[model samples]
Target chain A: MENFAALIYVISSVLFILALRGLSHPETARQGLNFGIAGMALAIFTTLLLPNVGGYFWIVIAIALGGGIGTVIANKIEMTALPQLMAAFHSLVGLSAVFVAAAAFHNPESFGIGTQDDIHLVSLIEMSIGLAIGAITFTGSLIAWGKLQGTISGKPVTFGGQHALNAALGVLLILLIIILCAGESAVIFWMIALLALSLGVLMIIPIGGADMPVIVSMLNSYSGWAAAGIGFTLHNNLLIITGALVGASGAILS
Target chain B: MSAVLIMAGGAAVSPLVFQLAIFVMAIFVGYYVVWSVTPALHTPLMAVTNAISSVIIVGAVIALGAADASGFSKFLAFLGVTLASVNIFGGFIITRRMLHMFKKKD
Candidate 1:
């Protein structure tokens, strides 16, 4: 059964790769849409075949509600607002990663990692990466969305010692990470997460309005990394592969 | 130190090395292929990437489907799944709508 699921995942992954290739050309691009949807459909179905699935009441509710909202918004949105819409979507991806990270931390035993005392340093690092990157992406994308929406100033906001502040925060985040890796401390973990979120806010606020497209792609890449981090935490190879594929490609596109 | 000794000292480098290899390969593939995309197709190309990245839904689905998921975990997973649904649905439909306009005969 596991092997069957793995086989489906492999085929789905290949289709995803092909779908990406098709996206690269104008003629093949529209034709490629079916492949992507088919790939996603197979992937979702494959997950349902897993032995340990619980009651899916919540999942079903989420899909219906989100699908309804998404369809309405997508059909109504103007082309001029696509950039912001994309940014807002990236924020969703980012927030999704954050939620996944929180879920993992909430219950390590279910993931087959270890008891509360036996957490591996590697997993801790992975979790922290998920936590920090997810938080950063969430807030960063929000700020980008805000800038695009004119709720936030589009001009580059500068102040005295801004670069210095970023540098300080960057260094402090690293220190906190090192400490967290050396030992299990929830307080320090949340602290690092907060700092990372702040870093995201600061990183985008200084970029001018003309560069929002670049920021959009950058956020896209960040969202991928956030997913990759969650993949590491969950010990899911497919997530790592898919997330890395998105992250690297998005970086190149940016 | 020899390679063996160095690996023994490393806590989690192998997974990273493998992951990095995949990342590099994807980057190269994307770089050439995406660049080859004529500027005429940039919008649709962007549309696809946006749609594909929301595969984060996979994680949320798995999380919410876990047998032992607690209340908090389920809630978060539900939120993740919901938002990711928004991304995929909005992204693909919008892409299709835009592409429809291009498909019409003059």
Candidate 2:
């Protein structure tokens, strides 16, 4: 039974790959989307059948709510707002990883903040990544949204000393990562979280409006890499493999 | 017997969903095909659809990755990202082509 599920998973992954290929052409994009969605549904079902997938009610509820909301948004949102939507997707990817990492960290087996368990390490890494990526994705996406919606100037945001500020923040984030590795610490976590959000804004704000598609693509790739990192934190072989596939493929295309 | 019942249920539902999905896909395929045939409105239509496609990715990633917090959830997150990447890449290629059409002297 498990083997069959695995087979379905593999097949679904292939479909996803093909769907993506087809999506590259406008003529075939809708069909590609349908294929991708169908593939995802299969993947989701396969995952749900795992032995550890406790409680049926929550899963069903989530599916209903998530799917319903998604359908409505897809049908209702205007074409001009699409870039903002893409930013929103990046933010969600980061948020998911962060939440999962938080949950795994708080699990009774680990030190809640810091410990040496492989799973905990994975969770922490994912959490840090999520915090950083999600924060940036949120703010950067908002900026992108503003630009697309005509609320903000479409010109790149820049200043004489901007790069220097980003460099200083980068150094601080690295130091914080090292500090978190040494012990279970809350202050350091908050510090890194702030730094990550700021980094996202800095990286994105300077990009020109004409480059919105490229920026969206680049952030999409970042989200994939962050997911792969979270997968590492979890020790789930499937997640690791899938995440790696996504990150690598997104980078290639972007 | 339990497995048989499960298989039967799967058989009953998957086909129906697949058919519906295909029908939905056909609408898009046909729309784009017709749009492409009309040189006058192609660029504007493509531009509009490109934006719609981007939002689809966002919605997919968020809906799939929300709140379940399982290993499966992580996998879904990755899937969401990949799907979005696909949408963006595909959308851009079409956009580039559309813009190129304007650049060339007609």
Best by lDDT: 1
Q: CA lDDT of each candidate? A: 0.77, 0.51
Q: Which 10-residue window of candidate 2 chain A scores lowest in summed lDDT?
A: A108-117
iRMS of each prediction = 1.8, 11.9
DockQ, per model, reads 0.54, 0.04
lDDT of 1 by residue, B32-82 (tens): 656566665666666666777777787788778887778887888889889
Give the per-residue Cα lDDT of candidate 1 at A187: 79
Clashing pairs for model 2 are A122-A233
After superposition, candidate 2 runs with Cα above 4 Å error: A1-8, A25-31, A108-123, A252-254, B1-106
Say which candidate scores most in DockQ. Answer: 1
- Residue-wise lDDT of candidate 2 within A172-206, one digit each (tens)? 88788777756647677667767777787788789
